[model samples]
Target: MQDADKNGNTNQTDGPEHSALLGRMLKGEKLALAKLVTSVENDAPFVPEIMEEIYPKTGRCYSFGVTGPPGAGKSTLVDKLIARLRAQDKMVGVIAVDPSSPFSGGAVLGDRIRMQRHALDEGVFIRSLGTRGTGGGLSRATGEVLRLFDAFGMDVVIIETVGVGQTELDIVDIADTTLVVLVPESGDTVQTMKAGLMEIADVFIVNKADREGADKMVSDLKGMVELNDCRETDWKVPVLLSQANQDQGVDEIYKELNNHREFLDTHTTEGERKAKIRRRHFLEILGHRFVKKVEMLAREDERFRDYLEEVQQDDANPYEITKTFFQDEEFARKIFGATQTKPS
Candidate 1:
């Protein structure tokens, strides 16, 4: 597999068939799009090339991230949101990040089963991405998948994280707006407070509003939003109540989503927020590339294997070995393939 260079360029050449697939995807062929998505999910050798080709078509779609603890009715809310967007004649894409199946590494809760009502909607595209043991409540391919949806001309893309609280905060880096859903149960409010969800949420929702303690949870979130001084933006986080199954308060959620979008459009035009997102993306790509290169070397290079064997046999200090490995000029050349300069 070809890797990206220091200048973020890929030398991997795609075959004629791969080029044809990209062309078909650009022409709005759903099958072609599906194939490209599978390729991205699998981290195919030509992914960097595919992303480079489609990048210019991205940054046109707005993304929303819905996340919280389990059983907060996130999937139901996403279903309603998709319907609302489709009603406005918007092309919607949904990436439902679900728990991975241990045996097959596939999404345990399939997208088709979760949002079956929209399965037939031509304007709606839904995909399920397994967490695949990724710690951030999302698949490593999620950001790339979002780009795919954006380039596919989606007006709105929604990412629903694996209902894991706290560590699920990675969504804030990707989503333009994040809605943290909670239920009326006791301790849920305290958990949110302790988990720092208040800081990441643009909007806090107490779903299943008909249940006991819903009003109090809403009020608590509102109070937390008011007291949280870390927010540098003028947009006050709204805490709304909803019974997503009944579609209650969904219109309000939709309205707030539009309001937040407008706020971003007005405030984030070439601002630090956009710059920060771009920087995060760059770092993520760089980190992934480095890890891949190390893995490749471990598999293919005898020197790297020798180091690993030494460490495995406890014949060398792993940390010292790593330090020495970094100082080796030839090893650097092999890993990065960049021209090196000698010290004066």
Candidate 2:
């Protein structure tokens, strides 16, 4: 895929001239917002350079992630949250992750559609992200966008992921605060919660609270939460009720979020959260380096392609070829050239 120019949604331009994009983003230039995000989404070479220029002004925003099963009213809740945040005169950025359609390889992109009322509001910046075939429920660019919004001086950045299924727990690594939403009387709430979503919840919201069993569902969640890890004494995860469409009980939800952020700001939780963020960024960097090294080596090493052709032709057995693929001296040489680090 092609990237945009730094001034025009970030194209394939190559040079220090694009550095102004970062400065313009921090200055709250709207066009710069689109362009800078384009660079991050495409993993353009200019991303690191842009981020380095903007790094000092980063981390001003409180990052919150709202994640749950489909039909749990997460989008509605997020919409309500944005309303509350905006009433306080806060600048907000929302990144909504939509599932991609396998057949079409395009996201429905309905999240932004649901949020159309805010499209005209200058204080609210919202972007829709397709998972991009990641299977992991979030787009690869979600974290990078979070940093971008923070550097742009957003007061709060809320990220909503496609559903809180198993590996989609990747949200925990990226979000400073995560809210897990559920419906009342979903029968399998406990079973689904057992899939690790319960442990990740800083705030448990019973969205669609006007529904028949909302209260009962909230009670059941509280019961399960206590029995599961009641040992935290006062560390209970609050279960708030919200009728997202009607905007009922959203203020209290915001209160809970604020309280959780305050709790996390303490000395102990502060270090742990920062450490996790560091590790998350480190793994991302490592993944980028890994793929780049493999691609560069495969391009430069003739033996690498030769081995593949051999495997296809049955001139080499799987096990023997695997050994050769790794131990090939040229593999080491190309990798070292790409990564600037020696292979073990």
**Backbone clashes under 3 angstroms, per model:** 0, 4
Who wins the TM-score comparison?
A: 1
Q: What clash pairs does model 1 have?
A: none
The segments of candidate 2 whose C-alpha lies over 4 angstroms from its true place after superposition are 1-13, 101-113, 133-139, 230-234, 267-272, 299-301, 311-324, 338-344
- Model 1, total clashes: 0
Give candidates' CA RMSD values in order. Answer: 4.4, 4.8
Instruction: Report the C-alpha lDDT of model 1 over 31-52, residue by residue, as the tens digit.
Output: 8888887777666667778888
TM-score for each candidate, following the candidate numbering: 0.88, 0.83
Please, what are the lDDT tens digits per residue for candidate 2 over residues 166-251?
54567555777889888875658557557376667878888887779888888877887777662343556888888888888889
Candidate 1 residues lying further than 4 Å off, grouped into runs, are: 1-14, 99-113, 132-139, 186-189, 192-195, 338-344
Model 2, residue 344: distance off in Å is: 23
